[model samples]
Target: MSTMIFSRTDETPGIHGHTRDCTGAKGSSTLAKLGKGDIVVVDAPDINRTLAQKLIDAHVGGVVNTGAFTTGNVPNFGPQMLLDADITLVENVDPELPGKVKNGKKGRLNDGKVYYGDRSIGQGEVLDEETARTRFLDAREALIDHMEALSGNTAEFVSTEAPLLIDGLGIPDLDVDMDDRKVLVVSPDPQLEEKLKSLRYFIREYDPVMIGVDQAVDELIGHGYRPAVIIGDPDLISSDNLRSGAAVILPADPDGHAAGLERIQDLGVGAMTFPAATGDATDLALLLAEYHGASMVVNLGPTLDLDRVFDTAAAPGTPSAMLSRLRVGNRLVDSTAVAELYRVSRSGGGWLWAILGILAAVVVIVLIAGLSGSDGFVDNLIDSWNNIALKFQDLFS
Candidate 1:
């Protein structure tokens, strides 16, 4: 019902920047703060798919962004996600309008104009599904042009000093039984709940090792699963989860400090710090599992959507995440397929139940024959049943 501006600039062109309705936080953080019926005025040059997805999940009324959705800025699928969610996304809005809005405040968008506290300040162009489609295609083409510049060389995505950074970066020395074990790596993605439900049987049957990444710890506990290890920034994870007896792993900052270590230190629980890597917490968790020699890794809520190229300094195509997967190889199984495999395993026991049912039916028929005093008929039925059983056994043999 109201508008909030996301900006980093001192002042938007033609509009005042120092408004109470504006947020200087990044787009994803801004979306996290805003909710349903909120209007997000993105003053940044581009929004990533992660933030776009947040806006969609928030069920926001609309997004009035002043920045262009170029290949370098916007995530590839950001525009499509907004369109599919039917969230009104107005690109190339008047830059000045965003600054007019307040931070943590409400405003309205109507008739190509933004209104804050009942006053119209600036105009914006509304992007429909068709327009979003055209924009996404153009962005893809531009992305290809940029990729051509790199000549498909993935080595460029990694720093030459990566080997130095990773060498001897203190990883967790905790011993985990990886022999024929199913290790479940969980992420804080929204689809995690559904995916966890599908894996319930496998979880109960295999009793796999659970590793929660960041906010995924909450999901794991909420779903009645205890994480053997929780890794990530403590700010995103709950205090209870951190104290849940799980070994904590966090990215060691350049200063050799980890954000999560401070939270768990007072509890007398120890934590291991690894050198900060390119990908987010989920990637780090996967790498940790691989390092520990997990027999099979089941990933839930992993970032599989590769259609993003935000304007931020974050690398496109997620080389670090890809590298983590390559490290794990065929041992990595998606949650959906894992659930199917578990379901099939459970169904395999159905024949035993069917045979039991047949035995019960035969007993009931024998009782009926006894009660009716039909000895001859009962004897013939028994003979025939015995013959049938023998024939079945012979067929199997």
Candidate 2:
């Protein structure tokens, strides 16, 4: 997420705004209909950073969640995220608040109580910046427990899927050649459009095999990058984009559900399935890229922080995210790392090219002046160059 200026002051924040029901946010695209400064009510326990980022982007005046904002099960940075942005976060409100509070109804949140047009709707634990910070620190103390759980789950995953992980069984052979190519697997995210815009330089230079994970194609196409391959639920993608010639890699878990297979069949489009797929679409894409001999598999918009992993992860079943990363090993690079290194390299490299071009132009000009056998030609050229330099300096300054 990008850095944002905290808009709060040293005052008891009493926020009043219209309500927007976001209880089943995962089941629908609610952000499109959501207006700026609308008070959002969601039912997310241990709200992930990704969803928090989206809410922050939506410019919601406040949030009323039916579940614990942090839950203390994992070190979730979401509560603090909302607090940091000066957005009032009232957590653990009534579960049936969504039913009681209709969308577009005016509500005021203050001192842990929610009032819908002067009538008290419900009350919950209101989180301020300081309280959230303390909660987050306490949550971090449970990291050891979280790590143990992750290790145990990953062990269980490996033991059950030994044939797939150890023997490379069920990995599909695709017509797309991946030998020595840098495969870029992009997942759908609220921050994806902004992130991709920044990485335009890297994409242009490497021209990596663009793999869109589910609705990520929307952002990729928005940024003018056509996906070379799509791996996810085809239902999430537009019918028009699906027919855009990109090969589809559908997730077919061993449980027998092939996501979007029916849709693809209806469209008369062919697809390759990653049998017994596990994690999310992005994980399967990583596994495919790594298995197909991709030199480097760059995952866009996923954090290296394990604490935030599962919250945003396409995990549990499709492909196991933890194991998939383990399988890829050193080849897997997050977008942040790529951005940091590539940006530094180009910042210096650009000046070198500019200097070389300037030197070459000077030599040609001097050679012309000498060949012309005119001292006045050289003087005229110098005056013209000085004038151009002053104009450029003026423009920039």
Error of 2 at 106 (Å): 29
Candidate 1 lDDT, tens digit per residue, 1-397?
A: 9777865332422222222232354544555566667777775445668767777887777777777543344336777787788776666767677566666555556666676544777776766777667766766676666556434434754563255225424455776665567899988877788889888888878899998888889878987889998888887887777878888888765457677566677766777876654437777777777767788999997455444322223345366566667767899888888888877877998899899999999899776654553457767677767777999999999
**What are the models' TM-scores?**
0.56, 0.61
Q: What value of lDDT does candidate 1 attain over all alpha carbons?
A: 0.69
RMSD of each: 14.3, 11.5
| Regions of candidate 1 where Cα sits further than 4 Å from its true position | 1-137, 145-169, 308-317, 343-360, 363-397
State how far residue 253 of model 2 sits from its true place (Å). Answer: 2.0
Q: What's model 2's lDDT at 128?
A: 76
